[model samples]
Target: MIAVDPEEGRVRLSTAATEDRELWQFLKGLQKGEILSGTVASIESFGVFVALDDGPRHPVFSGVGFITFPELSWRRFEDPSEVVEVGQRVSCEFLQFDTRNGEARLSLRALQPDPFATFADDTEVGQTLSGRVTKLLPFGAFVQVADGIEGLVHLSELARTPVETPEEVVQVGDQVSIVVMEIDVERRRLLLSLRHA
Candidate 1:
């Protein structure tokens, strides 16, 4: 029980694991950054559910662990299936206990190496790198510099001549040379210039 109004004869019950002493204790004992192994039980548009190999079963869900789509991988993907599938065995870092949802929030990407950091370590401003235009927008074009790393070339940086759109200079899948303008490792972003290429 969490709250109650004696005069109104109303009571509010909590769904926290506190009601299940063993589960509550287990959840409390968990520390962030701990690795947890589990099997993918179900996949949803928002996240994936995992049936933990060690924890007690969830009262309502098929799994007691959950991983958000962004936590599944460092690479950009259109769907969760691109990163993981149901029944796949996975080792994820425990992010936190989702008290509201009664599940352990996990991150599969945390256990993997960050491609951006590696790219940044080897790259410097003004260094030219060969890349393929992966996407084009009105403001700029997105170029894939590495396997999972993409850099943006703003319209003003596309060329010396004024351009209205990225398509005026480059199109998707077009291999192009670009100079690194900025590598914001903290923000995990890269700004490039086709004009200086």
Candidate 2:
């Protein structure tokens, strides 16, 4: 559809060709939770861009697909390249259609079994586990007990003696013994206690 204003000499175009319509229809048919295959178009610090095999070009960007850091893989990785490379074929679960941006939010991890689910099923509260300190914050430290599972050891749980920060007692890459204080399975959060361990 094209509209013109003779007085202002302005024009607007709103129609698509048959192929464009078909492409859009195909994109529209995709639903959340559906798995789709695509090639890795590029990798950025923030996310990975995919060129979907049967999807339309983004109305804005060069690609119509995207996968954020957390959605890239089941395991924790510092870089996207560790899990996928440019030109690699991948299967991802469609998360949602970003109508405003004309892109699909996809998750590569959805195709894999959740490590947390398995961890929770086999573990119980008060279980002592050995872990490596992966990160430290003002309030707590994140300890990786399993390949992809991390638990938080709050400042209060760090030691029997009072401490101002986690760094006072533990640093990154330190092997620590921690007790599982609480588990919120629905939320996928694990609370650990270094003092109790």
Candidate 3:
């Protein structure tokens, strides 16, 4: 029984398909790091739903597999479609069984190499590199230094002069030269500075 209300003589029994034997059987068969193939069932602002080729149909969701936006790819994208389209076949790494959502959390990026790791392996602090501005915020601007790699240039580092916003120095898509101020592999962060360039 999922819920009960004795005074009202009402009971919510386990009718959800996720509570069925098939779901448990599918989940039990899943192991983290295992590859799963599926078709993209739907794409939402939050994530993409995948219809696993081997799993039972989901109880409530459109598919039994789910991939969050970040897991879609290592590269940044403005829309989910930029990474995948509905009905497209894809292979993903099974992250875990998401009990709350009754779906398996999957990652498409896990099947690809991490560009940040390669960038860190070859790059160093004080190295000057050119990048295109990708986003502007009150605190900083994000610049794409390499494929699937971005670094933050804080407001203070945008210019030698005090600036109110990143727009004061750069705009989205502007090519700018920057110096590597820090590369924190532990935190997976890369800090850049235009002023020091």
Clashes of each: 0, 0, 0
Expressed as tens digits, the lDDT of each residue in 74-118 for candidate 3 is 887889999899999999999998765578999999999888888
Better of 1 and 3 by TM-score: 1
The TM-scores, one per candidate, come to 0.89, 0.82, 0.84
lDDT preference between candidates 2 and 3, better one: 3
Which portions of model 3 miss their true places by more than 4 Å?
1-15
Top-TM-score candidate index: 1
Clashing residue pairs for model 3: none
Give every collision pair in model 1.
Answer: none
Q: Name the runs in model 1 displaced over 4 angstroms.
A: 1-19
Per-residue lDDT of model 1, residues 140-189, tens digit only: 99999999999999999999999998888888999999999999999999
* Whole-model lDDT values for every prediction: 0.89, 0.85, 0.90
Q: Which window of ten consecutive residues has the lowest lDDT sum in model 1?
A: 16-25
**Model 1's lDDT to the true fold?**
0.89
- Indicate the residue-level lDDT of 20 in model 2: 60
Error of 1 at 73 (Å): 0.6
lDDT score of residue 153 within candidate 3: 100
Which 10-residue window of candidate 2 scores lowest in summed lDDT? 13-22
Error of 1 at 17 (Å): 6.2
